[model samples]
Target: MTDAESPANGSGVGAVRSHLESTISGTLESRNAGAFVHAGSRHDPTVRYCRVALGRRWPRERGREVVAVAFDGDEWLTASSDDASGHPAETLAVRLAERSGSNTILTPAAVPHDAALYLERAGLDLASTDVVARARATKTTAERDRIADAQAAASAGIRRAASLLADAAIDDGRLAADGDPITPNRLRTTIDEAIVSAGAFPAGTTVVNPDPEHAPSTLDGEGTANDGDTSEVPLRPGEPIVLETAPRGPDGYHAGLVRTLVVDSDGGRERRAHVGATQSFRSAAAMLTADAESVTSVEADLEAEVRAFGFGEGDDVRTRAFGVGLEPCERPFEGGDRIDPGSVVRLESAVHVDDGSWLRIADLLVSSEDGERAAYLEAPSRSLEPSALLE
Candidate 1:
């Protein structure tokens, strides 16, 4: 499961939680005397204010003692007031700040503008950009395991989709199973069901781009089959199909996978591009070692590898490498920030074909302790030979 999906046990917070505390403590120290006020729901994606404040999942009924213990004597405040007669959450937070002898309250940058204004008017100095995100970016060992589990589950979903494609029968220009032509919607439903059965949440929209050469403008709404009903199109042999899925495990961590495939067609050009993408992925993975200096350098190395394979970074080709954690695409790598050991990243390479078709491959890689090489979390073969899928 992803770290975001993983349930926090009753046990106190560990390394990641401690790092969050240290980050907030450091921020508080720099700003003089103040407490960090995290105002948000328990499920807020960006801040997860309650989790950070409590050092674990929020205990709904436990009163101030739990709060005091989690804070460890540090003056911290939370806007969890449900009492309508007393004060609104924001107003209560301001009052708590006043009583705690802290004149300032550090809030996350994701706070709504209205809430920020309220804090400002409460006679409390408000600082934006809390350390929660920074702490989240650098995951602990346990968090990495959760992410790995999520990635594994996502990979399982991809395998299930590939298996369906492999077993599908091509009749004329359409793909079918058991005498029924398969539609994109059917395929997506099957994929999502498989993902859920495999212990991961169904990714809302699994992109299924059939006939990549003449890809659809968008994947919104129910898919189309050949007849233009809800299922508007049918899978045609020889056409390159791009399948991308980002599934979240029960723990709330997300993992992504993208692969290009073809049925009975001659896959010479597509195979070449697939090989190029695989090679580029390897080259990028090599740069994720402990000694890697910066994300910019790694991206440059990846781009150079793609260029070496005769692919340009223009409209035809696309590449991405970023860290993955609570979110499918996490920070540092997303922001092109510095490289740190133990950061898990996903690297992708795609090359467009002359016919508007494209082949792409993506995999997860974790930085090594020495920062010289990365460990491949998912290293499936990238061969585009039809036999590979058929068998």
Candidate 2:
């Protein structure tokens, strides 16, 4: 590398290291998110550490004594709130502003639905930018390590999820671990249990698409499948099963992976189709790394590949594979999207049919070399047939 490039890269790495240390130390006040604390533990000290980290990253435009507010907090009492009016809780921004003698406050884009109007009413100057969003999108070396572990955890979850389905398909209603009739509800129940065991939190979405009849967005959804039927659909001999697993690691990095499998019979046609689509996704991702193309370009490339693979053309294809770190789905994948070097992506090419089961084969990757190369969490299987379930 050139001397200039070396220093610049070094500085970026130093910045990430400094930020994480200070945040973990809890020397500063934070505004962007709930302070970093241990998982499932009640400790307010984490807040102080996060404040220091986030506060330091606060742009000078926010001015000294900058206050940052994370929309998702314990004090948030409502599932949804009017952002135009300040919520009832004592906001971090307000309190920090008063303490630091700063008049301006910044908020994450995920701020309440009416955040713009609400901040205006609070008598504080407010501005919105994806500064934090972009920063969080790219994964640092340390951050990527955490994400790698998280992705491994996700891979484990996917295997367990698929195993449960396979057991149900072959074992005449008998569960895999519990040895009971594997019902739809039971499949979800077992999956949740496995997620917890894997040391990750469960998202509301489903990574598995075993049947066309059951198209619930998330595996944990209690709502009936697309058909609105309660009848249980266990894994069958020739049915395609999509194993999609996304779980937040111990350090909060999201790792997402999807694999398509057929219980007893390898669906050759579906497997070949999935392989072709996955290759296209790999190509698009390669360009994303090489050219540092915006999310839009990546999305377009993926869509084009899907159409080439003989999937329906146009926007009808379900395609979005972008950054998923800190909070999953952190960036939108569309053409002309400016690139960030540290962003991690879960680029996916989903294959859905009209009233038939669809599948997704995806991998969580980190962008590097100024967006020229995408580093996978690990070597991902290019096809549905895993020599051994990926871990």
TM-score of each: 0.82, 0.66
TM-score of structure candidate 2: 0.66
- For model 2, how does the per-residue alpha-carbon lDDT over 217-267 read when each residue is reduced to its tens digit? 224334444645332444444555566667765444567777776555545
Q: Could you tell me which 10 consecutive residues in candidate 1 have the lowest summed lDDT?
A: 64-73
How many clashes show up in model 1? 21
lDDT of 2 at 37: 18
Superposed Cα RMSD, model 2: 10.6
lDDT score for residue 28 of model 1? 71
Q: Residue-pair clashes per candidate, as listed?
A: 21, 26
lDDT of 1 at 204: 73
Predicted model with the maximum TM-score: 1
- Stretches of candidate 1 off by over 4 Å are 1-6, 10-12, 49-76, 79-88, 99-102, 210-218, 221-231, 312-315, 333-335, 370-372, 385-391
**What would the per-residue lDDT of candidate 1 be over residues 11-76, giving only the tens digit for each residue?**
424665666678778877776646665444445554352353345554444233211111212644
